[model samples]
Target: MKTKAVRLYGKNDLRLEEFELPPIKDDEILAQIISDSICMSSYKAAIQGEDHKRVPKDVSQNPVIIGHEFCGIILEVGDKWKHKFKPGMKFSIQPALNLKENPYAAPGYSFKYIGGSATHIIIPNEVMEQGCLLEYNGDAFFYGSLSEPMSCIIGAFKANYHTESGKYEHKMGIKEGGNMAILAGVGPMGLGAIDYALHADRKPKRLVVTDIDEARIKRAESLYRAEEARKNGVELIYVNTGTVSDPVKYLLDLTGGEGYDDVFVFAPVKAVVEQADKILAKDGCLNFFAGPTNPNFSAELNFYNVHYNSTHIVGTSGGNTEDMIDALRLMSEGRINPASMITHIGGLDCVVETTLHLPEIPGGKKLIYTNISMELTAISDFRKKGETSPLFAALADIVEKNNGLWCLEAERYLLENADKI
Candidate 1:
């Protein structure tokens, strides 16, 4: 079968090409991709190409598709797995597949035949055997794509530690009923962390999210409403640190002299990292959430505090299978809303350009529906653009019906009328 995909050839070389897909093997399953959300990690993979650890060394020779956060419908299940797997089953992948203790070789970065940025993909035997393929029966398929990034937040919270008596051990999540802060960037990933922190089972008493961009921070506040958070017993504060003369002092004041119990550095900037470190209370866990692309990226830390005050630092690349499952379960149960992190939506045809200039784009998550072909449209613009464009008009009506938010109804409307647009 022929499929259209965004394939990586070498460093900074991504091509939108049509290629023939081999027949599904006995242990493989063919899936028709529904939605694929672009990630910052994919941006790094595009620039680093073969240099990326998960990307195949011979990527120049065997080009691989470059997307990991995606979900699809099972088109064909191999005969050997007929009972276990079936056609029409919906699934989201935990792409950080550490199969057989192999640290490398994930679907988006390494697998030549399997990726999310394509019309169709084949789930490999190893991925299935490791149970990385999660069956999703959500209202909207985009939830599957958003689950991967949401899982990263879940993993960060799960990996955060607190000292128990004499020794430090994993608390398996953020400090319950403690103050928390998300530093620097309130981009897509930061927004996810905020939603999780506010709505999770162990919700924080006070959550302060900081960003440099006033517009971005305001947009995040509108989406993840501070009023709603406060009503839910979380004292949510969104601050534009760029406006403040002293961001560290402002954040410290929000906690009433006591520093944040858990501080998350959402930006790769060294200054933000340093500031996040300084605002940590005793036994505070500083999570370096954003992965820095530069190998020489270093920030000065108060090691004295680390030694004496039980302040610790940790970083994680991606989430585990359990984290992915937890994210999905929460989204399904309406405990968390991953859709708020999405601002723009496009089709698979825009994957190449979107992947190449993702950093330049200002919006949150740019979701691509593989079956459709359309330009990226902001959900916020639907109402205004609805005046001229009938397509946007329909979308505006749908979003309006769903409290001016992109929900399952809006997704279904867009998919049903994708050709009309």
Candidate 2:
């Protein structure tokens, strides 16, 4: 069948084209993508062209589909897998298909598996055999595609950057209550990290979120204030890195010279990594949430300090199945609202235009509904064979009034209607 998807031809070139998709085999399942989210890495691939890692070496030489984070429903399942999934059943496809053969066979970034940016994807029995699909018959937006990144955050948290707690003495380290600093980046993932840190039961005494965009900082502060009321006392600061002469010193000044307990460096710039050592607390741990794509790219830091200070530096890529389950639970519990980060909404076609020019958009997540109709389509398309459910129909009304409000309200809607999806 013909399917519409975003294809990368070369550097700075992305096109929405129609192509014939392969049919589903007996042990496989076909999914019609309902929603997808554009990540920073997606844009990187668009700019770097064939050099982007997501593009398989052989496929990079040709036109290949682009996308990793997405939510879809089962359209057709192979006879053998019919018991596991059924038609019309809503499910979220974990895009990272780590086959034994692919080196980076992790979810979301695996070079061997195609992503969910297209209208439909066929899940091979191998993935089913591995058990990657998660069933969710409730309210989930295209932004739900962010589960992978959230899983990465969980992975970073599991890395244990802090020192273990003794009987009484609270030797500050990267453990449960370690302070976290999200630096340089102010998009969906960074925003999501901040939300996760804020709502986490073992949240740090102080959470510092930084970005180059004044508007993003202001929005984050406003959202944090509104979402977290009981913990309203928590300090949320916004600094304009663009105007700051010395960001490192500025960040240190905010910490009162103690340094952060745990730092999440979301920015991929070389200078950010180079200066990360100075801002890090004596025994602080730094989680490089974002890494430079170029294999040749390297960052410099003080090795002597790294060894002597007992500080840790760790990095995480795509998440695993366990992380995704926790993320969904968090979403369902209304702890971390993934929809809040969605700043832009459009159809599949707008992906190339908006996602490609992401640095210009000043907000959180850019959501794309795959089934959206043509006339109503701007960011995503979610119009399937069935009629729009009354629940979503109501959401569309709210989304039209205010995009931000839709994000805030959708989480509540999802929670209230959780059991009835």
Candidate 3:
């Protein structure tokens, strides 16, 4: 089979090219990629290339595709797995395949033909054996693509642990009815964290989301209304910390002078990390959720509180398959909408440039439809582009109807009318 994909040769080396895919083995399955949401991890991988752990060391001779959070449909099922999976079924993958053989080996960064940027891919036996090939029943493929990142947030929440003084056993998850704060929490992943915290079974009495950007804070507040969170019995507040004289003191004041029990640091910045530490209540679990590309990223923490007050820290890279299942279930039930993370849409032809320069671009998720030929366009600009293109005109109408957010209707319209790659 022939497939078109963005392959990584080395650091800052990405090329969109057509190549021949080998026949799938009996232990493999063939799939057609529909949508993929570009992640910051991809940007890190593209810049570091082989230096990235998940990326293969010999990528120059054996180039690998670049993408991980993807959703697609099964095109051909091999005989060995025909009973469990069949052709025509829609699916999403749990890209964090921490197999015993090689924990670092994963799709996208580690594979030659099985990344999300490709038009078609061969799903190997390792993915199915690990139970990472999930059958998705959602009407929108972007939601399926978003499930991966959402799972990461869920995993972070689950990974956070609280402790009882002098006890060895650590209690898992954020403290219920406790004060919680998400520092620098108005970006893409931070928005997902806010959504999961409010809607999940575990609830915090007060949820404070802080960001340096007032515009992003307002935008997040618009998408997730404080009034709506209050209806669900959680006090949600968005604060622009840049305007505050002392962010740590100001955030604690919002919780009635009590420090937060669970604090999530969304950015890798040292100041943000230190700020989260200063606002932790007794037995507070501060989760450093951001993945820093620098090898020697460091931040100072208070060991005095760790010894006396039971304050601790935990970090998670990505969620497991079980977390992915939970993410899909929540999305299917309409409990959490990952749509807030998406800000731009593009096609296969745009993957090379988009992936190479993702950090330079401003937005949440950059969604890619693998079979289309179009430049990366923001949803907010759909109306402005509508003057020249009929595709953008129809998409603008659909987005505006949905209150300026990307929806299934917009995706369907774009897929049906846009030029196929």
Per-candidate Cα lDDT values, in order, are: 0.87, 0.66, 0.93
Estimate the overall C-alpha local distance difference test score of candidate 3: 0.93
Please report how far candidate 1 places residue 85 from its true position, in Å. Answer: 1.3
lDDT of 2 by residue, 6-107 (tens): 777777878777778777778878887777777777888778765655555554555766777787778888899887789888776565566676644433
Ranking by lDDT: 3, 1, 2
Question: Ranking under TM-score, best-scoring first?
Answer: 3, 1, 2
Question: Which residue segments of model 3 deviate by more than 4 Å?
Answer: none
Error of 1 at 297 (Å): 0.5
Best by lDDT: 3
lDDT value, residue 117 of candidate 2: 66
lDDT of 3 at 227: 91
